[model samples]
Target: MKVHVHVSLKPGVLDPQGRAIHHALEGLGFIGVNDVRAGRLIELDVADDTSDAALDDMCRKLLANMVIENYRIEKVAA
Candidate 1:
């Protein structure tokens, strides 16, 4: 089984790195560069028996910070 986890900051949280990247893009003459938000993608291959409940536990325990970020889990069979 393969799983993809996306972790991102909730709205209203300042993203300095994203802001800097956006500025750099603008300086490079890229137009219509609207807002930018940074995030992370985690890919994992687990045993076929891994359950949704277990994946959720993984996210809550190690993949995401509930206080500042949100996470989504997607599972696929190998």
Candidate 2:
């Protein structure tokens, strides 16, 4: 099975990398850009029998920071 984890900063959290990207876009003459939020995608290939509970635990314990980040798990179609 293939799993994808999308991790990002939550609302009200400061994202310096996002800010930098936004600024760079503006510098490159891009317009109509309001804001940018940076995030990460993690791909995992696990056994077909892997349970949802275990995947969620992986995100909560190591993949995502419970303090100011949020994560979503996506199971890819084979």
Candidate 3:
């Protein structure tokens, strides 16, 4: 089994890295881009019997910072 986790800042939080990337895009001549927010993706390969609850716990405990970020999990069959 495989899992993917996306971690991102909560709404209303400022993302300086995202802002810098947006500026770089503009300098490269891309137009009409309104905004940009940066985030992280974590991938895991686990046993077939791994549970969603366990995965969620992993996210809360170590994979994400609850004070500022939220996480989403996706499971895939490998």
Candidate 4:
């Protein structure tokens, strides 16, 4: 089975990388851009029998920071 983890900063959290990217886009003459929020995608290939509980635990314990970050787990179609 294939799993994808999408991790991102929660609202009101400071994102320096996102700010930098927004600035860069403005510098490049891009317009109508209000804001930018950067995130990460982690792909995992696990056994087909892997349980949802285990995957959620993986995100809560290691993949995402419980305080300022949020994560979503996506099970990909094979």
**Candidate of highest TM-score:** 2
Q: What TM-score does each of the candidates earn?
A: 0.92, 0.97, 0.96, 0.97
- Clash pairs detected, candidate 4: none
Error of 4 at 75 (Å): 0.7
Order of the predicted models by TM-score, top scorer first: 2, 4, 3, 1
Better of 1 and 4 by lDDT: 4
For candidate 1, lDDT tens digit of each residue in 1-78? Answer: 899999999899899988999999999999998899999999999988888999999999999999889999987556
Q: Which candidate number would show the highest lDDT if scored against the true structure?
A: 2
Candidate 4 lDDT over 7-57, as tens digits, reads 999999999999999999999999999999999999999999999999999
lDDT of 3 by residue, 1-78 (tens): 899999999998999999999999999999999999999999999888888999999999999999999999998667
What ordering of candidates by lDDT runs from best to worst? 2, 4, 3, 1
Clashes of each: 0, 0, 0, 0
All candidates' lDDT scores? Answer: 0.92, 0.98, 0.95, 0.98
Measured with C-alpha atoms, the lDDT of residue 17 in candidate 1 is 85
Answer with 2 or 4, whichever has the higher TM-score: 2
